[model samples]
Target: MNKLEIHSPNSPILLTASLHVDEARKAIASLVSDLLTESQSRNEAGSVELVTLDQAINRILAEDLLSPIDVPAADNSAMDGFAFNGDCLSSKDDIVTLKVVGTAYAGKPYEGSIGKTECIKIMTGALMPNNCDTVIPQEFTESSDSSSVTFKQNQVKRGENQRLRGEDLQSGKAAISAGRLLRPSDLGLAASLGIATLKVHRKLKVAILSSGDELRPLGQALDAGGIYDSNRHSLTGLLNRLNLEIIDCGIVRDDPASLKSAFLEAASLADVLISSGGVSVGEADFTKQIMQELGDVGFWKIAMRPGRPMAFGVLKPADPKNPDRKSLFFGLPGNPVAVMVTFYQFVRSALLQLNGANQTEPPLIQAIAQTPIRKKPGRTEFQRAILERGPDGRPTVRLTGSQGAGILRSMSEANCFVILHHDQGNIAAGDWVDVALFDGLL
Candidate 1:
């Protein structure tokens, strides 16, 4: 039963005798890296456009951003205090008093030279006066009048509480490197360096579709044995989070002609074509046949629960006019929960790479399992679980009510995926397990 058998006369045997089911069950990390490499090979040098810093959020940097001027252009005060020469302090055990020469506010400077036994009332961000090298907070000293102040010995140190020019960033230094996706902090840093516009990579275009005769689009009345198409909506929402240009191809019926037309159109329109359903071993599944005729694709039963059946390859144009057109294709399982799990585990990172993002793998944290989990040793299991803080502030997890692949509520209710690794057996209560958090992307 490991390899799908085709017994129907009308269904062509797509699985070759040389196909190895065991070899097709790749580890998730290795498979993702291979997909990213393949995608990078197809992606040419990406084009770039100039955009203001306000519009650069989530965009990939096209080149190194060098600072044209120093951050904090001049030496300023780091606190609202008295600015004075450190040499004027007597000793750590005694108190010293000095005349308040003047007051320096932000955007204003005390132009006169600072003499011995003289200090200035300097506010935060005010320019440090000439010959002044230390700052003592106003609260740390006693001010008898507007012109005189007292400071306790050793209340402040030399060059302490002073902001030096170019301390954050120096002119001509790279502020941000290429390939970085701009965030809010990155935009603020660019603004500090006087960068008004930046060059960034264009957003990736993705085309998504679903296949099956038993599936109907939302707003359409369902016939007998038909289910409303929910995969497209879920896929579209996920793609939108990545900031991709989505080309939704809608639902394609389960027939050879309709599937072929959709595949060809999607290949021509998008850089990547994603399809859910019609990938498993079923007599009515015409998607496998049409996909085989169109391009190089491999059907696999990965050693993972919740999402096992998958298809990966490239689709090329059959028309002579668009002979050079090609698009990466990913065929996901039909079940509602399986579609989401497979996309998050495998396709998310690949799409990020294709979109010119220097993507990092999401972090996995260890948590104590509050209940026992049923699992075998040969397959990895991604059970949806609710992570909570125990009385001692340690992370604990409990499985969602149902673990079936068709139960979409399991994914909706859970905050994290409790990853049971391959070669791991049934879990006992209180056993530590690795979990990947949703982090609001759900």
Candidate 2:
């Protein structure tokens, strides 16, 4: 078995990538490199701000957080046990007995000294009394009275069942590194270290707009050929998962004037603009034309399934007051499934880079193929599938109904994408495949 590091922007995921890059690299890798280079050249300082811990969830840390004091400032009992000197365990007999001097509760330490052959009943998290270096769980004591307790000598070792001071985190040491997206546990850890505020990257403002004359908004009547615009809603949900600030420019008509207006408005207000539809070679696709007129952009047919026609580049604002505020543009496919696939492939990492996050892609898992799948060489395919653990505990996957790009229902029913790499052929029932689950990434 070998490990392969697949990178998108600054995020690198280690997976078993045996084949995809031999031919597919030229298109996807080239585009990724260009976007990453541009993202790195941007002024990172412009995206940093100091925020309180209450408002720092999902935000990227701009600097390492050092602990102000040691965690568990003093040694404490790890469980409800009897605390005593380790020397008590050195008895030459099968059992050691000690008199109960007093009790120690959490927060209130035992002030009296623990003498020889004397122990204190300590609760969990209670500070270890002086001269005590070991503890035997209360359950281990079989012979016990009101004043004394007896336990086997070999039941516990020296310094057992005790939490050492500064063992978890030392004072003046880095508790959390920069570029980490703060989670609930991280906020708790910061509170433990007395950190009231943290320096974090400001949330990236992402504008979403869907194009096409046949598209209509929700809760509205539609014509014979018109369909509800789901692409914008899907893009909005995907962006919300990253905790970015959303600027909804709504749906734009397919005409050149309407498309150009929407493009200009999005670029001026957002750090990134994600639009679905109108990147194809259709006559109504004035999106590409307007994007090129506004800034430098590229329209490429990616060698991938579901999402092939992709547009990526920078959209420079026409506003003279903020001419330097340019937005990275991603024009995704019109199909709902294609929009999601393309977003995960490209737009996700680009947004993470602009938001100052160090990692972008989610970890890839491997599962056994439960159903036979037909494939052609030359293009990578992301098939929606249901992933489950077999009776033997190994993961297995099967396709979720029809694998059509327009069928968004399959994407909703599936838990993961069974990624068949480029140059790969048919997959038998027992073949191993790479999986990207939607648990955290989606």
Reference-based lDDT, each prediction: 0.79, 0.81
Q: How well is each residue in 221-298 modelled by candidate 1, as lDDT tens digits?
A: 878998999999989988876777899999888778888999889888888889998877673245666776787566
TM-score of each: 0.85, 0.87
- Judging by TM-score against the true structure, name the best candidate: 2
Candidate RMSDs in order: 5.5, 5.8
Off by over 4 Å in 1: 1-46, 89-93, 138-145, 283-286, 319-322, 428-431
In the range 192-308, model 2's lDDT, one tens digit per residue, is: 888999999889899999988899999989889999999888888888888889999998988889988889889888888888888775632456557658876655566689887
The deviation in Å at residue 118 for candidate 1 is: 2.4
Predicted structure 2: lDDT: 0.81
Candidate 1, position 18, lDDT:
25
